[model samples]
Target: MKKIILLLTLITLVFSSMPVNEAVAKSKYKKISVSATAYNELGRTATGFDYRKHPTAKAIAVDPRVIPLGSKVYVPGYGYAIARDVGGRIKGKIIDVHFKTRKQAIKWGRKKVKIRIYRK
Candidate 1:
């Protein structure tokens, strides 16, 4: 009788834990087109100095539906970008790449690229 009760309790615990694990693993993720801008570190002080702390290169925008804000994405052509800001003009499957310098960013201009979303 005691063994039977213990077995039932253990089974209940195991089943209860499954749903949480599945929800995390099954979090929706998808691929989208990305563009890159490469830039050298400049114009940081002029921007007020806080922005200078991190890499001069910044990721302007990405499709929020495809990649959530604050998520880190790896772009095939453009190294890596953190989904920072969104663009009103940019909608659907498009992303705006940011760079430290206008020269590099413009050089990259616009190009179709692939991005992989890293989920925790």
Candidate 2:
């Protein structure tokens, strides 16, 4: 009887402590057509922070109206990034990802990709 009560109490505590949304609260993302480009860290970003010292090395310039600043995004070929910078040409669905060198940026060139914008 004591063992049964202890088991029930333990089970209740475990279930109560577990987040109800832990399994169901996955981040919802919206897919959008984006003109993807790359930029080097030679200059400062529009955010007033030096490009090289940006929190995420994978910084992306995006039109605030389209993706908003300080957003988390996922680019197909470029993996994960934060929308932290902006440029004159980076309007609408266009995005400019930062790289370490001009050669690397040039290698990326320009292309169209579907990026996922995290909604959480």
Candidate 3:
């Protein structure tokens, strides 16, 4: 609907407005160790990221206090994604990576990995 488009547009604007010295991705990120989990649920996210709707969009749920919303994060096994969602259980030093399928989410399971966070 119009709301979805507007939300996506607003989120894009917010994420794009971040200040980064390096244009190349993963160049200016703060590396940190955290517990990473996976999820493939279809619902409304805290930041309005709907995997069912925008399946191709890379997104992650993070603790806003720790990683902040709109931050670009790079996972070890996974590729780069944006911190476009938040979860109640996702507290400090923990993150939830979004996958397209439950099988993929289950496959990912849980792991302790070093992630690169790019503030924006």
Best by TM-score: 3
Instruction: Flag clash pairs in model 2.
Output: none
Best by lDDT: 3
lDDT of 3 by residue, 2-50 (tens): 9999999999999899876565654567899999999987777887767
The alpha-carbon deviation from the true structure for residue 104 of candidate 1, after best TM-score superposition, in angstroms, is 0.8
Q: For residues 1-120, what per-residue lDDT tens digits would candidate 1 score against the true structure?
A: 999999999999999877666556775545665554333443332224334566564554756776677777777767676777666656766777667667877788777777777663
Q: After superposition, how far is residue 91 of candidate 2 from its true place, in Å?
A: 1.4
In model 2, what lDDT does residue 11 have?
A: 100
TM-score of 3: 0.74
All candidates in order of lDDT, best leading: 3, 2, 1
- How high is the CA lDDT of each candidate model? 0.64, 0.84, 0.89
- Backbone clash total for model 2 is 0
Q: lDDT by residue for model 2 over 5-118, one digit each (tens)?
A: 999999999999988683367647789998999988656666666755553478799999999888899998888988878888887989998888888889999999999998
